[model samples]
Target: MKKTTILDLVSRKLAPFMLLFGLYLLSYGHMSPGGGFQGGVVIASGVILLFVAQGVGTTASLFPFRTLSLVEAAAFLLLLAAGLAGLAAGAGFLGNPMAGVDVRAVPRVSMILVYNVLIGLKVGAGISFVCMYLFREGR
Candidate 1:
């Protein structure tokens, strides 16, 4: 059966907030229970809600697979580069390096925050792409 107007409306209305909350989760993951993977899944769930109600064609117009693929790759590379930076700093891969840096506001290169965001982006895009493909195939 086709989706109802209420479903469409609710999905659209709530998705932005869900996305925002997912970001919040990513940001505060170091201090709280949730983290990158959870936030990424949350963001994808919002998008998937729209996809389920609106169809892949419509969702694809807004979030094309190519764009998400690029995002996924870029996020991975960024995460990798961050890891390499830690290694170059004489720390282990993905190690925190700014704990003793003299700079006050250079972010101390908060690895937790950075990794959470990168992981969130990668996972969100990966999951979205999979769903898009499945939807396209009518699976």
Candidate 2:
């Protein structure tokens, strides 16, 4: 969709807030309806607002595609590493090391938060990068 300058401005202004809320969604995914993928897509929508308002070049400068790609890759790798750590620690693959973790005498949800955050970031950046590239192709 062709976004007007006003839409763009609104999106830009809302980006940070969307990001914060996305984080919240990811963190609470296990206990709620949202998750890494959902929250990441939400964050991507926020970035898309920038592209719509400022132009791809300008938005890309704000968030370089190369950096976003690297970050996405690294986040995925970190997710894998975290899982591996659980395995190495005597938990099987994809096992929850935090299964035994107690926070204030309550069992912690373990690595769910980390996974959510990483996946959210990866998904958000990856989608935003694609949209930015597509948006640039026309202009």
TM-score of each: 0.91, 0.83
**On a 0 to 100 scale, what is the lDDT of residue 4 in model 2?**
74
TM-score of 2: 0.83
lDDT of 1: 0.86
Global fold similarity of model 1 (TM-score): 0.91
- Which candidate comes out best when scored by lDDT? 1
Best by TM-score: 1
Q: After superposition, how far is residue 139 of candidate 2 from its true place, in Å?
A: 7.4
RMSD of each: 1.7, 2.8
Worst 10 residues of 2 by lDDT: 101-110
The local distance difference test score of each candidate is: 0.86, 0.82
Q: For residues 1-139, could you state the per-residue lDDT of candidate 1 as single tens digits?
A: 4788899899889988988988888888888988999999998988888788888888889998899999999999999998888888777888876654666766664778999999999999999888888778444
